[model samples]
Structure formats: structure tokens, C-alpha cells
Target: MPVIRPRRLRQTPAFRAIARQTRVHPNELILPAFVREGIGAPVEISSMPGVVQHTLDSLRRAAVDAADAGVGGIMLFGVPAVRDAMGTGATDPDGILNVATAAVVAEVGDALVVQTDLCLDEFTDHGHCGVLDARGHVDNDATLERYADMAIAQAEAGSRLVGMSGMMDGQVAVAREALDAAGHQGIAILAYSAKYASAFYGPFREAVDSQLQGDRRTYQLDPANGREGLREAALDLAEGADVVMVKPAMPYLDVLAGVAASSPVPVWAYQVSGEYAMLEAAARNGWIDRDAAIAEAVLGIRRAGADAVLTYHATELALALRG
Candidate 1:
């Protein structure tokens, strides 16, 4: 009888590399970027180091950089200069997000998929993801009407993928119908299917200059409900979502795996702002090896079954992977 050991495969770097079951490739990463309405220069987000609110000029540069780095795509979020009850900016053709989407598409459309965040939060004065009713509760059906308009706006702006991150019920169907009716049937919808209401979103609020006075737990999935995440993914798939996503990837890897295992469409995950901030803060404090930790963190997400990851580290990690 011969004694067997797994150590033989782990004995060398080349062996480990060859035996790796999951690999993080440049094409499997999407960079999430912010472009502000009136900024002349990029403003670094205090809560998220190395992440910034970009001016239109700076956004073009960043898009070029991401394209050069070979990232699969760039997801754009706009910080509007003005806000309104109806979130008029979201549907306006000259709105900040629409403008940024067009600019990024022109800069790197041929090189990578240019995506837009199709949500009203950044444009709404109330900071809710949807329009409010008479009593100030989010109006689901009314918001769907707004989403339809926003979907067309994004498509006209040259966004190849419109990320429906507002988590509105039936949003994917509404956006799909609106896009097809408007002769923009080629556009894809990336549904944020199982986005959890987590504390992990705190830094993102800062990044987008959020104006919320309370919380979004009413719409976003509760953090404790893993089964509910799967149900949401299924709903999105049935509603014509080209892709479905689980956000705050690391904390919800279990949910990610659940969706990945069951969904027919591509399953993507977001490494949100707080996650990036935590890793950066730790690395800056010398508590962890920055590059190694970043690599491992993303690799863990990839291993958990994300077909692509929306991450702040996309460019850097893509470069490292290419090297």
C-alpha cells in the first residue's frame, strides 16, 4: 500500500498554478466608477481611499485606463448636482449619469462593455431608490414608470448594459419592455437581484453623496435571508435579466453560491465600497499584505461562483493578473 498526500501538488508554485480550479482573469472583473455633475476634478472619497468622484474629463481618463488594463467593463454611477422629488435628472437626456454614460462609451465602448447604474437614489432628493407616495413610502408602480424612462435614457446614452440596482419589484420587466419598445432591444439589463441591506453600504453612500435620513431595508433584501436571495434571483431571471448579481460579495458568498448554482444567466457579485475600505484600511495600517490580501479576497469571490465581479480593485488586479 502506498501513502497518499495532497502536499505533492502544493509543493511548488507552478504545480499550484496548474492545479488552480478558479482563476481571476481580467475579463471577469468590472470597475465601478463615480462621475459627479459639476466637479472640475476628481474628489477622493474620504471613506473609500483611492476611490473618487470623477469629473467628466477624469471619468474619460479612468475609462481609458480601465480599457487599457483589459477589464471586462466599467459600471458608472452619477452624482447629480440637483435633486428633485420626481428624480427628473434620472430621465433627463442631459443628466449627469446619461452624460457620463455617453462619455465613457465614446472613450471605451469598443474595448469594453460600458454599463450604467439605473437607479434614482443619486438623483432623488429623498435618497430613496424610488419615487415616494403621498405618505412618503416608496411607490413601487410609480417607480417602475420612472425606471422605464431611465432605461431608455441610459440606452440612448450608449450604455450597453443598464444595471437595475434599485431592487424595485418587476423592474427588470419594465426596463426590458421600455428598451424594446424604444428600439433599443440590444441593450442588456443587469439585475441587482439579491442586494442585501447591509452596513457594508455605508461607504457607498459617501461615494455617491447619499442623502438618506433613514434606511433602505424596506426594499433591499434583509441580510439574514439567504433563501430570499435565491427567490429574488429566480424572479429576475424570469423577468429577462441578462445578468443577476449578489452584492457585498464576501459576506454573502453563500448567497452568491446559491444563485450561481441555480441561475441560468451570468451571476455577478459586487465588492462594495465598505469592503474595499476595510481592506485598504487594514493594508494601510500594516495589518495585512495589500496585494496578497486583495488577490485572495477577489479569488475567494471568483471561487464562490461569481462569473464576474464588480470591484474597486478591478484595474489593479487585472494588471497584476496580466503580469
Candidate 2:
């Protein structure tokens, strides 16, 4: 007998297909969208090539397109026309995010889930995710109140799921309580449980026109710690997170796998701005096969145990998969 012919399965397409353990589906992908307050035309994010900060009208069209493509959801981030110390726009019923959320929900209806980025960084003048204390540090308890308010605002704006990406301690519990009290009991929470302070967010600054003055090392997880990611997930789950997410998915696959293995709730990952930029840059330089690389990256994320993935490439990937 031949000695353990492992190549037998690898030798044919049918065998390879049967052996494949992971796959990317349109229904498991969510598109991340940026909608700006005062733009007559959609503004392309230079760092993120094909991606753009959409006007309200354009954002509506994009959401409909994503829904028609069979994407699972669209997570909206708003760029307001002004900023303040308290990030008031985050909780304002009339805020740009709220308006955009309403528009998307109305446009797509039940075709796809509409989610909102429940972070204040985009609205704060100082660019921190929360309000600052007299000493200049983020006031954790005070910030929790703001988060609770923002959650209710997003929920009222028609966001089915509010992504708590601020990484604030006790935020999930507080937001959950606020939503329940406001009689928005059906709203869900998608906690950014394992978001890390990575350099990968560089391009996102331009996308949101972020005003961040300093690093978020105090609140965001350190990139070096994998075990901490699980702890954060556990805490968020205990506080009633409907789903837990690991951000900048490619660099944190180990963390993603660990969270997926232990998490009782669904595990999702964000293929952040930097990851998308690298692939685009290489493709533009004729250095890599973009489509194949995109497929491989998303498949690898799914294999690492992500139940869903939020990516800039969601619509394109969905269209390609359908073909």
C-alpha cells in the first residue's frame, strides 16, 4: 500500500471542495458605510480607493444596493458638520447619523439589518470616544451615561443593532438598560469587545474626518494581549451583548479564534480600513491578485470562527459570489 497518500484528496477539484471547511457567504457579510453631513457629491476616501463618504441621498442608494446584493447588514458611521467637547451630536436626535440611519432603514426596510456606530469619536472635537475630565482623562462613568443616551438615539433612529465601539467599561450593561427603559426592548447590542489600539485605523481617520488628538490606549485593548480579548468578551456577554466583535480582523485572528471558541454569543470581525488599503495598494501596483486575495482573507476570517464579517469589500464580494 502507498504510505499515507494525503495528496489523494488534494489532487482533484471535487476532493478539495469536499475538504473545504470554511466559506464566505453574502448573508454573512456587512458593509461599513460613512455618511457625511454636508456634501453635495460623494467624496472618495483617498486612502481607501474605491470607498467614499456618501451624501444622505447617496447613502440611501448604497444601502439599497447592499440589501439587493444580499448583504447581511450595513453599519453606518456619520461625519457631522461640527464637533464639540461632549460629542453632543452622538446623542442628538437630529444628528447626521440619526438622519442617515432613518434614511437607510426606510430605504431597505426588512431587506437587510441597519446598524449604527455608537461611538463619539466622530463627533467629539478632541476626538476621544468619550468626554474628558478636568484632568484630561476620559471619565468612564460619565461616558457610560453618554453611551446610554447614544444607544437610545440610534435605536430611535431605526438602527436594529447599535455597535458599541467606544470600548468603555460597563457600556453594554448601561446601554441595554437605557434601551429597555425607553421601551426599545427589541434593539440589539453589538459590542466591540476586543477592539485594539492598532495603527490599522490610520485611513479611517480620513474616512470619518476624525478629530482625535491623542491615542486611545487607555480604553482600547493593547494589540499585544490575546488573553485580554477573551476577558473583555466575557464581560460584554455578561452585560448582555447580542454579539461580540474583534476588530482589525487579519492581525487578530488568534484573538478572534480564542473568542470564537469560548463566546456563547455570535463572534464577528472587522476587516478594518488599513487591511482594505493594503490590499488595494498592492492591486493597484500590479503586485497581487485583488479578487483572490479578498476571497482568501474573508475565508480565512470565517475559518478563524467569525459568524459574520464587516468589510469595505462586502458589496463587491457579494456581487462576485453571486456571479
Sequence-dependent TM-score of model 1: 0.99
Task: Single out the weakest 10-residue window by summed lDDT for candidate 1.
Answer: 101-110
Tens digits of per-residue lDDT for model 2, 1-323: 88999888898899998987787889999999999998899999999999999999999999989988999999999999999999999888899999999999999997989999998999999999998999999999999999999999999999999999999999999999999999999999999999999999999999999988879999999999999999999999999999999998999999999999999889999999999999999999999999999999999999999999999999999999998
The true-versus-predicted C-alpha distance at residue 254 of model 2, in Å, is: 0.5
Off by over 4 Å in 2: none
Residue 170 Cα positional deviation in candidate 2, in Å, after optimal superposition: 0.3
Where model 1 places Cα greater than 4 Å from the true spot, the runs are none
Error of 1 at 63 (Å): 0.5
Pairs clashing in candidate 2? none
Per-residue accuracy of model 1 over 1-323 as CA lDDT, tens digit each: 55898888998999998888998999899999999988778999999999999999999998898889999999999999999988999989999999888888887767989999999999999999999999999999999999999999999999999999999999999999999999999999999999999999989999999999799999999999999999999999999999999998999999999999998889999999989999999999999999999999999998999999999999999999999
The collision pairs in model 1 are: none
